[model samples]
Every structure is written in structure tokens, then in C-alpha cells.
Target chain A: MNARGDTTRKRLIDATTALVREVGYANVRTRSIAVAAGVAEGTLYRHFADKRSLFYAAVLDRNAPIVAATATLPSLAGRGTVLENLLEVIRKLAQLQEDLLPLEQAMIADPTLAPLRGERVQMPLEGPPHDIARYLAAEQSLGRVRAECDPTLAAISLLAMLFGLAVHPLLGNDLAKSELLGASVSYFVDGVGASATQPKLLA
Target chain B: MNARGDTTRKRLIDATTALVREVGYANVRTRSIAVAAGVAEGTLYRHFADKRSLFYAAVLDRNAPIVAATATLPSLAGRGTVLENLLEVIRKLAQLQEDLLPLEQAMIADPTLAPLRGERVQMPLEGPPHDIARYLAAEQSLGRVRAECDPTLAAISLLAMLFGLAVHPLLGNDLAKSELLGASVSYFVDGVGASATQPKLLA
Candidate 1:
């Protein structure tokens, strides 16, 4: 990417994000994006051949915090108490999600965008869940998590806890964010048993 | 308060659900819904009183399975092994979420649908997560799950796990549905720790 190309790409992403915010997800189109970016349709074509490519780049660039967060995850995953490390990653993702609420809705709304599985989607700071899953698996072999525990499920569940809150923030249903998260972490660290491993976080 | 009223309400709900599924979430309208249900606009209002009411009725009715599962959750949240019991409730919700796919997408795409937060969104099951949450709290009091656990977060996490899978199905993500679900459940049961609590499934 040359300087000119880089500038054009950035402009294109900025335009798409703006359009998505101004109107709505389904209303966006290639021509509209190009026009918004103040470039000819052919110019957008030069940078990215189609609307889907443009959309993907726009989404990826718009959510840079996800990328940045994923980048530092491996080190975090390896350090700290395993539970602390996991919660930290979840919190980081939640914060990124809060910052990009519009894109999150757009991603969920567009069925075409659903193919971003672990291997295909490259957010900046992702890829460590796989390594963490493997590490957790090694521990299971040696009896860290329940010997019968599944690491992939653990990774997905952890991610789900964060995403769920991000989706629900003040949207309704009266669960205070901090209080809810405190409970979540406490529950996850130790089971919901009265007689458990750790002391009561809320108490 | 007779058969006529019952039929009218049913027609309105059916019409809304059909419209939501057919034209996508954004294009649905009161007039189109009235036309679909073969009722006059005035007649539609006589039953639903408003568009929001119609929408809520449709969402609630379409999600009968989840509602039913939720209502039944109290039975499972107590006295059993922590992870196993938790997984069973989550699995029940996952099955219920299959019916909620389109409505869930609509909520994401349109802010108008944001009223869902204030609405008492429940599984068709009488008291699924709420009951389960209460039960888990009791179990926490009784020394079943981790004493510090927030059953509320656990409950929400359970729903979101299925939702994440629903958004990206096994077919689309190149994963066998069963295999992915098994892995998902395992990870969820285990915290981000090296090992995790195992789930027990009873009813």
C-alpha cells in the first residue's frame, strides 16, 4: 500500500462507517459509499473490487480496538492467575464493544457478514483464544480445570459473557453493569455453590 | 372476552410474525400486517391496541419453546452437581433460541425494537432463567455452585452462548453442529482456568 493508496483506503473506510451511522445498514451501497468518500465509483473499484470487500474493510477498520486488544492477549493469557487473565481479556473486549455499538449492530444485521469464524476473521488482537484453549487443555490433562472440562467451550462461554453485556448495556432489564460483571466473574472463578473455593465477591 | 377476541388476537400476532420474517425486520408496518391478517386496520387496533403490543405478542408467542424451557428451569437448578445442572438449563435455552433467531436479529437491526429491554422477555417456560437464577442463588446459599456466583450472569451467559452459535451456525462456520455445541458447552462450564467445573444434565 503506497501513501496514496493508504489515504484512499482510510477515506473509504471513514465514509462507509459514516454512512452506516447516518442512514442504516441495509441502505448502504457501493455507489453511495464511493460518493460519500468523494471519490469516483471507479476509484473505489481500484481500491476494493466490490461492496463486500469494502464492507469488510470498513468493519475491520472501524473496530480497531478489537484488533488492538487481540494483539496484547497472548501475553495476558500467559501471565496472571488463569482466571484473572481470562476476565481481563473479556473486559477488554467488552470495552471495545461498548466503543463500537453501531458496527456491532451492523454486523449482526447483515446475514452476509456471518462467516467470520475464528480462522477467517482476523481482528487485531484475536488468535490467542486458540492458544489459550490449547493451554487450558494441557492443564485439564494435568487436572487444572475439571478434568472433564472442555477448553473450546470455556473460551466461547467467556467470550459470550462479555458480548452479552455489551449487547445489553442500558438497553433495559435493570442489571447494573458493574454489579452484573462482578457477579459473573465471581461465579466463573468459583462455582455458584455456597460452600466454594473463593470468598464471596459481592459480600 | 370470548372466542372472537381470542381469534382476533391470534390473527394479529400471526400477522406480525409473518411480516417480520418475510420482508425483513425494517419494512414491517401496521398496514401491511393488517392486510396480511385479513383484518381492517381498525380491527387490528381493537385487538392489539398498538403496533408495539402486536410486536410483543408475536415475539412472545413465537418464542413459546424458550418460554416453556425457562419456566421449567427451577427444577434443574438445585441439588444437582453444579456444572451439569447449569449445562442442562443452557441447553434448554439453546433449543428455545432456535425459535428466537429472526426476532433477535430484528432487535439488533432496529432501535425501535429496543423496547425489548423493558418488556418482560421470558422463555415460554414459566420461569426458566429467573427461576433458575433464584434457585442458583439458593444453591449458592446451600453450598452447591461457587458461593460467590451471580446466577444472573450465568443465566445471561447461557442465553448468549446459544445466540452466538445461532448467528453463525455450524453449517456456515464449517463446524459440525453437535461437535461445536459440545465444545461450546464444555468451555462454558469451565471458566478461563486451566480446568473447570463439569456440568450435570438432569431434565
Candidate 2:
């Protein structure tokens, strides 16, 4: 926590970012990252537990936008219309996902990296969906969202849709992203039932 | 085209299955597959245009349950309750995805195998969603689904949820699969709107 230690942490993360961009995640190694950062290989172990944790820290630092947006989720629950708040969160998640695509592909390619992920393996399960579910539950308490609606499933559905939308372009599936998202969010908010009343989203 | 050619094609496919299972998709090569099948490496090119095509054919062959379920989609248009038919398709997709998980992970790991997938890259874009969209449109025509609903988005949402459910177990996200799925489909069919009428699904 000293200035010297903080500087070392920053240097290690920066080195990981540079090395990951240069060699790709599948090819990156702890010693190489240490070498790139101009530190002893043992220094990496001192600063971080493993390469996966190091990379996760780097990703979190890089994707501050999404992290910040997700943190503000509960505050937004009672403020804006539910659909608007949900869309905003999803939009941020999509942007973050777009940035993380290469890293995700690389991680999937390297089997050794999987077990190193440790606690981070459960991060995705606890991320935006968890926040969104909480937000929905809050809104339900406020009488904005339907009380009987299962917030967890709804949150998962929204998160899944956001993931699908984000990966669609990456996989060469051509979709009018913004337009389709608007429609999808509208559908989610209003439901597709014949008798369901559609709410007008704020501009 | 001839009996001899048919035998060769079957041999090549069988070879791919054995090789994929033995060495994994990231390690399988056309030459190794040919060597395993006791055929000239060039015989593989004659049977299939490339390794991706061969893998695609193998996946389709192995996933007969999903293909058969999908093929029966149109016949279910007005035959059963819309939710019943939709859940049936989703259940089949979940099973197929679970079966194909290893291959899917393997393919994601290997970059070289990507471009060879050709039109199959757009397979998800064209597969269950395409059929489901058509079925939903038909239901809309029959006054089952709301006419105002965007069938494409509905289909995509359902497909996305199905994919999430499929990958949840693979990624160690714990949810009661059937229960969560039932809630998801019900929410999709009835919407989360308090005013929406829910349908009774056949067991």
C-alpha cells in the first residue's frame, strides 16, 4: 500500500496490458510479463498470485466504464424509467464486451489459463446480472416493476441478450445493433403478450 | 456419388469424429484425420472441401436430435400451445448444446479452424432462431402470438436465453435449470407485465 508498492502494481498491470496486446493471452506467461515489466520473475508472485489474477486486474482497470455503470445501478432503479436504466447498463456492458473480445477468445484458447482464473471464474456470474437483479428487486419494492416478476431470471435474460448482441457483430452476424436493441428492450419492458400495455420510454 | 464414394465420405466423417474425440478439435488436422482413416490426405479434400466443412458435417450428424426437433418446428405452428412448442424446441437445443459443449470449447480455442467454418459462422444466425422466428410469425398469423410482436427479436431473445441456460452448467453458474427455464419462458410468453394473462403449458 506504500507509494513504492503501488507503483510496482501499476507497472505490472501496464506490462500485462502491453504484453497481452503484443503476444495475445494464449501466449502470455508470468516470466515474460515480469521481463516485459523490467522486474524479477519472483516479483510477479509478490505483486499478484497468478497470471489470471493479473490479467483480471488489468481488465477491470481497462473496463472502468462498465464497472462504474454497474455500481450506479441501484441508484438508477428508483430514478429513471426501468427500461432506460436497463438499456444504459446493457449498452455499457456491450461496449466492455467489445473491448474484451480478443482477451476472451484467447482465454478460451488456452486451457492452462482456466484453472488460474480461480475466484474470477465466478465473477461473470456475479457481475452485471447480479447488479441488474438487485436493481429490479429494488424497483419491484418501489412498485415500478411488477411484484410477481422474477428479478433473477429477468436479469439473466437481459444479460444474455446483451451478450448475444455484443457477440453478434464479432461473429459476423449483421444486425442493426441500436435499432434491434431498442426493439428488444421495448419487448422486454412491455412483454409481447397481446394484452400487455407498452410503456413509452423517456427520450 | 457412387457406392465407393459414399463409403469414402463415411470413412472421412468417422475419422473426424475419432480424431476430435481423441486429440480434441484444437489438435485435429486434416492429414491426421486422413492418416487415421487409412486414406490419402488429399482424399479428405475430395470428400469435403475443407476441415471446417468436415467438422460442420460431423456436428450436424452427431446432433441429429436437435436437427430433428428443429425440422419439426413448422409442423408445431398451430398444433400445440405456443409456449409448449417453444419450450420443447429449447429443451432439445439445451440437450444438443450440452452434448456439443466440448467440441464448441475446442473450436473456440483453435483459431485456424475458424475461417474454414465458412457459412457455418452464420449458422446460429440461421439455425434455431430462424426456425423459431418463422414459427412465431406463423403463430402471429394464427392470433396466438401478438401481431405487434417482432418475431425476429422474440426468436433471438428465446435463443439467447436457451444459450445462456446451456452454457450456465458448463460455466458453473448454479441455477435450478428447469425451474429457471420455466420462469423465463413464462415471462417471455406472458411478459412480466402484471396485467398479462399466463398460459398453462402442457407437461
Candidate 3:
């Protein structure tokens, strides 16, 4: 596409995102999206296949930063202390979930978005959890982590903690913004068993 | 109310739960709920203030088992091994989250349910997380868990793990049905740090 076409496409995605946030996926109409983007209805179809496609594009566009941050997790495996690497992982995962959850909930509730759900392409062994697992496995090999621990399960546990915290407020509890992240990372790195004598790593 | 009134109210709640599960919350009508319950439309209103109230009743009805389970956690502290208590906690939390999440997403997406959202009564520092924290504190006092570990943060972390696993399938990832619950409980009871020399609690 030319520079003008690219600009129009970006505008459409931005408008769709804002409208979805304000109203909801079920109520958002393609015509209103075009109007919000200052483009013709015909132009929206010219750029994307359907409303679902356009919405998918908007979600992906919004998620680009998180994807980039998750991609960087594996490389940090042997470069830093495992505690430091996991703290960064938890921070990024929290941000990623916070951004994606509303959009995901909207998709689940809207029948029109069913096609997008069917088309969901999962990388399976290549998300943040998998990346963290790979990092832990590497750390285990380097003798930084316990040899008996299951890296995959540990990764899932870590991911679960962050995801749980992200959705806690939806259940009417206040978002726990205390020293939870640091404390969790510290607990994870140094086992909570009475015999485990590692000094406290986080304040 | 008399036995007949109790039976009628139970029928209405059961009908509402079935209908809401079949159709999204936005699409469910009180008229349909009454018909499904084999009662007059006036019957539903007589039993409840509005559709939101009926829906709330249904949610609470479904959640009673989880509430009962969560209520048992604090009393179990120091009665059995700390590991055994936590394993039970993870099991109950995972079940609670799995059942509550779909209803929650529907509530979040539908505008008519906005009033119900505001009416959410939280027990604040008295739910499962708090209960588990109390248990941990009791165990810490008994010298079963490390003194330096923060019980509140540790409780939060354990809850986060189970909640995360419950929601993982929503993102198109297959529900991880491996030995995750056992693994997480073991990790929580015994930290993953290299120097933590407790025997692995779970296989």
C-alpha cells in the first residue's frame, strides 16, 4: 500500500479501538467505525476483509508492544540472575494481561466475533510462559536453579500468578498493588521451606 | 416462605442459570426465564426485583459450594501438614475460578448488568486469599513455614497461579491439565531456590 493508504489503515484501527473501549464490541458498527476514522464505508472493505478482520487488526496493533517484550525473555536466560529475569517477566506479563483482557472478554461475549475465535492461531509452546520455561531450563542447566524442579510447571505457576492478579479486581477486590510482585519473585526463587536458607532477595 | 414458595424460587434460579449458559447474558429475557421455569411472568418479579437480581441469585447459588470450601481453609491450619492444606486450597480455587469466569465475562460485556457490577459486595480481607494467609501465618507460628516469608503475599501468589490456569484456555491455549496443581503446591510449600534442600513433596 502507498503512504496514503497506510495512514488511512492506521486511522481505521485507532478509531475501532477507541470506539470498542467506549461502547463495546457487540454495539460497534462498521459504518460508525468508518465515520470515526473519517473514511468511507467502501474504503474499510477495501482495506480489510470484514469488520472482524478490522477488529483483529486493531487488537494485534494494540498488542504489538507486549509481543515484542515477551519475545525478549528467552535471550535474557543466561545473561542475568534468574531472579532478575523472572521479575522482568512478571512485570511484562502483568502489563500484557491488563491490556488484552478487556478485548478478550469483548470477543468472548460477541457472537459476531465468533469467526475470530475460531481462527485463533496459538503458537502453543511459544508464548510468555513457554519463553519463561525455556529461560528456567537454561538457568537450571547453568546451576542457577534447582535441578529437581520442573521448569515448565514453574513457568505455568509464574504465569498463573500474574494472570490471577490481573483479573482479581474484576471480582470486586481492590487491585493488590503492594509488594506482591517482589515478594512472589523472591518466594519463587528461594523456596519457602524452613530448611532453605537463602537470604531474602527483595525488600 | 413456605415449601411451595421455596420450590418455585429454586425453579426460577435453575431456569435462569440454564438460559444464561445457553445464550449470552445480553440476549436472555426475563419472559424466557419465566417460561423456562414453568411459571407466570409475574412469578419471577414476585420472587426477585429484576433480571439482574435473578441472575445474581443464580450466580450465588452456583457458587455456594466454593464458598463452603473456602470457608474451611482457616480452620485447617496446623491441623494437618501445611502442604496438604495448600493443595486443597489450590484445588478449590481452580474450581471456583473455572465456574465463575464465564458468568463474569458476560456480566462485564452487557450494559444492562452495569447495576449488578456496582452492587458487588466484597468481603475484602476475608476471602480465600485472606483465609489462606491466615493459615500460613498460623503455620509460620508453628515453625512449619519460613519466618521471613510474607504470608499475605504468599497467599496472593498461590491464588494468582490457580486463577491464571483457570483463564488460560480463554486465550486459545489448551487447558494445561498436566500435574500443574500438584507442582504449584509443591513449589509454593518448598521454594525453587537451589539451596532449599527439602525433599520434593509431589511427584
Between candidates 2 and 3, the one scoring higher on TM-score is: 3
Query: lDDT of all predictions, in order shown?
Result: 0.58, 0.64, 0.67
Q: Which stretches of candidate 2 lie over 4 Å from their true place?
A: A1-65, A105-111, A116-122, A168-177, A192-203, B1-65, B106-111, B116-125, B168-177, B192-203
lDDT digits (tens) for residues B114-161 of candidate 3? 544357643222377777888777777666677777888888777766
lDDT of 2 by residue, B31-116 (tens): 99898888999888888987878887766666555555677686687786777887777766766565454445445445544534
Cα lDDT of model 3 by residue, A142-167, tens digit? 66676778888888777666655665
State the lDDT of candidate 1 residue by residue for A125-187, as single tens digits.
Answer: 245456456655554443334554567666554555555555542332332346556556544
Residue pairs in candidate 2 whose N, alpha carbon or C atoms collide under 3 angstroms: none
Ranking by TM-score: 3, 2, 1
- What fraction of the native interface does candidate 2 get right in terms of contacts? 0.31
Worst 10 residues of 2 chain A by lDDT: A192-201
Q: Candidate 2 on A98-166: residue-level lDDT in tens?
A: 545444544543444454433535334356677888888887777677667888878777666555554
Q: Taking the true A–B contacts (Cα pairs closer than 8 Å), what share appears in each candidate?
A: 0.25, 0.31, 0.56
